[model samples]
Target: MAYKMPTQKYSGKILEVTVGSDLKLGGESVLPFYGFDGNIGNKPAIGMEIWDIFPESWPAAVLDVFKDAADDPLKWAAYCVEKYKPDFICIKFEGASPDGLNRSVEECAEIAKKLADNLTVPLVIAGCQDNDKNAKLFTKIAEALTNKNYAFLSAIEANYKEVAAAVGLAYGNIVVAESSVDLNLAKQLNILITQLGVKPDKMLMNPGCAAVGYGFEYVITTLDRIKLAALEQNDETLQMPIISPVSFEAWKVKESVVTQEDIPEWGPQEERGVAMEISSAVGVLAAGANAVILRHPRSVEVIRNFITEMTE
Candidate 1:
């Protein structure tokens, strides 16, 4: 007699989204659901991070790559496109923050336009850490790039509901929600956004990722719970596509920055940085991540290959 395997039936619903002119999310069942058992519908997309101003405080390893284009957002974006062939460009308007250089909204908009013109892929515009400032800046960029379809405008938090509402009304691609590490809070934020008229299909969740040896386990656990809830069809908030900020986690860890002399046993800083990124991204993929923002081109390639294998 031959042994037979039982087929697993996934209860969760997958959201389908067409970004810009070419990108599409194919609908399928299963968590972290690539196109394996069933049709995943969309291939995971990668976004290279580009800051509005020169990152003088960045780790030496990161600084070394962007040394030439750090001061110019357009040139930097073009470099990422030419070198990495990223699926999308994620531009962070750090210069517009109050604590930072405080570049004006108009200036930020100008930078966004230049990048949009230079790149053929879709764009995701993120404001600085300040909610109020980000709201104003994000709105300006959304309006400026209206000609480009499928641009993801973010970070609609609890304090910036009004701005989020405006972006929703504009019908531009938008990312709304929070990183509470709590399932209820995540759902509540999504509910709030929907109440304001934002469609569920257009929203993306960022539960946030902590570095390895940090609170990574907790982050993974939270994401796992969210994914389980979504798969069980018990929570609609967790159903939307998820975006993991992998680069942010990689850059913040001391292991990724400290020199060999400072942390001799930790090994090379460059290797550490890459390891941090790959580990963080792989962990999130297990939990449930449809998109990821990364800094290094090598990590992106490794992750892409890993995802391809999983789906195969």
Candidate 2:
């Protein structure tokens, strides 16, 4: 006799946020990959992240994969989309940082326009993690690419209200609200952003992520709590779809960046980095990230396979 598994019905579905024209994220009425228990609104999406400035410090493994393309954002992005076929391209304007290139908002906006015009997939514009600078950067970029919809990498509570009004209200571009890995902060940001008229359907949430072994359990626990709040408890604010940027955190860790000479038994540095990225990415996806941005092609390949096996 076949054992029948009972389904735990959920109250609300995660809002579906569209990217790159027809591609949609979220929409599940139950926990991620528990389709037997409920509906799977959409299969998870993956992205490859690149920087506007040459990532001179990139690990040899990743640099080898990108090679010449790493020298230019447009070339880097083209290479990623053509070779790896990520669901989207996350263009981090690291050069715009006041400490880095200190590029003016006007200059960064122009570069963003170029990427938006050239890329086949949707663009997720990322700032250099400076709240004040991002407020200006996001606004200028949003103004530049009006009507040509794209997603922002994030709008933290510190600046999301203003960003939500500018990109979301002014240009109708998708907004992403980010909060540290805390359910209360996540819900609070959602509430604040929505108050400014950004619909959940037009917004995504980023529960700030950590490297696989570095405070990563907090991320998983936070994601799990968000799922519990939204699905069973019917928490509206926390129901926004989650997008986790894995590559930045995964690649910067000591395990990924340390050299073979520095640590003899750590195996090949490239393979180790890719393994870290894959572990962190898959961990986030399983923990309820609707989208994850990875760096290495190999990590994307492995995670894509994992997503297909689980979703299909």
Candidate 3:
């Protein structure tokens, strides 16, 4: 006898967002990879990260991957695109940190313009977390890439007004509204951005994610709630696609940093670090993230294979 599939139905679908020239993300009518019951819309995109300045303190496992191109942002991005082949490139403005390089906003904007001009894929431009700096940096980037239409990393409730206003200046650009692990905060931030004249389709959410061994469950639970609110509760405010900077947070943990020499029982350093990132990426994707920003090439390859298997 043939068996029937037990499927779950959703009342609402996540909004479809087009980035770059023609890349479309999100638009799923059910939970992730439930193709038998609903549309997967688009495959979850991978945004490979490239820092504007050489990441001096990055773990060897990550730095070694970009060793040759670390000094040049443009080349680094190109190498990531050509070699690693992510769906998009996310240029992180780590140089602009107040205690760091304190690179001028204009300088960062210049880099963004050059990357946007040269790359064929979409760009995800992330600014420094400092609200004041991000406000200045995002505005300058918006003006610099005015006609290019790239997405900006974030506009939080604390400073969404300035960032949203600046990003809204670009016709096809979108903003990631970051909130704490709280669902209400996520919804509220989305509402605030839409109120700033940005449409709901032009937004993404980043409810803070944690590394696998620490608060990883928090990331999954929070994402599940946000997705449920969007798909089941039919909360229009929470319907936009979500992004998880999996590698960004995963690499910061002790598991990804501590050398095997320091702790002989931790197994191999590179393998351990990769596992942490891969586990986090898998968890977030299953929880409903539309895309994940990754740092390691191996992690990207693993996640891509996993996605391919699930979709197939």
Candidate 4:
């Protein structure tokens, strides 16, 4: 008898989302890129990370690469797009944080608008987690990018009303609903955002990604459950695409932050950092990540290669 392949059926599918000029993400009928079983609407997309201001706390590994471009947000983003050719660009409004530069909302809005005007690719804006500050920043940024519908406004949790309302007022752009590692919390957040008048398809879930060595297993397991719920139990509330903010979590760990001199056993600082980001990203992709936001151009290249190999 001829050999046969077995595949499981799924009733749920990921929502397809478009950003920037023509960047499409999600819409998968199977987990990740299991094309043998179902349709892979679009290959997982990667967005290289940039910041509104120079990241002074970044180690030499990351700092060295963007030293020149760091001084100017526009220039830095342009460099990432032109040089790295990422599927999209993600700007972390770290400067708006209370402990950071404490940049005014107006200033942050101006920077976001400038980047939106310049970058032809899709943009993802992640503001600091301060409820009041982030809500204000998100409102301004959402308004600024309303026309293009090119930006993804991050993290409508704990402040779902304020941020989701901002996106609603803007009339365009996607919202990222975030939750802790808990699956129920993740689902509840989605429901809450949907109730606020944001369509479920227009939202993406950030299910609390942690780095490789930092509770990574918990993240993997949580994501698997979420995917299973969506596919097996036909959970409409959980069918949205999943986006992992890989860099921020990865860089905070000891393995990624420590210097070679500080930890001799660890390899070169640059290579170690890239490995951390890459490992975390790959793990998430395997567990069912539809989009990954990353720092470190090298890590981006590596993950892109992995995605191509797996999908092809």
Highest TM-score: give the candidate number. 2
Clashing pairs for model 3 are none
lDDT of 1 at 244: 76
Q: After superposing candidate 3, which stretches have Cα over 4 Å from the reference? A: 1-3, 170-172
**Which runs in model 1 stand beyond 4 Å of their true positions?**
33-36, 147-153
List per-prediction Cα lDDT, in the order shown: 0.75, 0.89, 0.87, 0.85
**lDDT value, residue 76 of candidate 1:** 87
TM, every model: 0.92, 0.97, 0.96, 0.96
- Residue range 1-312, candidate 2, lDDT tens digits: 999888889887787878868779998998889989989889999999999888888887779888899888888899999999999999999998988888899999998899988988999889996889999999999999895668897899788877999989998898998888999999988898889998888888898898889999999999999988998888888888899999989999999999999998998999898888999988888889999999999898999999999988
Compare the candidates by lDDT and give the number of the best one.
2
Cα lDDT for residue 266, candidate 3: 91
Output the TM-score of candidate 4. 0.96
- Among all windows of 10 consecutive residues in model 3, the one with the lowest summed lDDT is 165-174
User: Which candidate, 3 or 4, has the higher lDDT?
Assistant: 3
Q: How much RMSD separates candidate 3 from the native structure?
A: 1.4
Ranking of predictions according to lDDT: 2, 3, 4, 1
Comparing 2 with 4 on TM-score, the higher-scoring candidate is: 2
Pairs of residues clashing in candidate 2: none
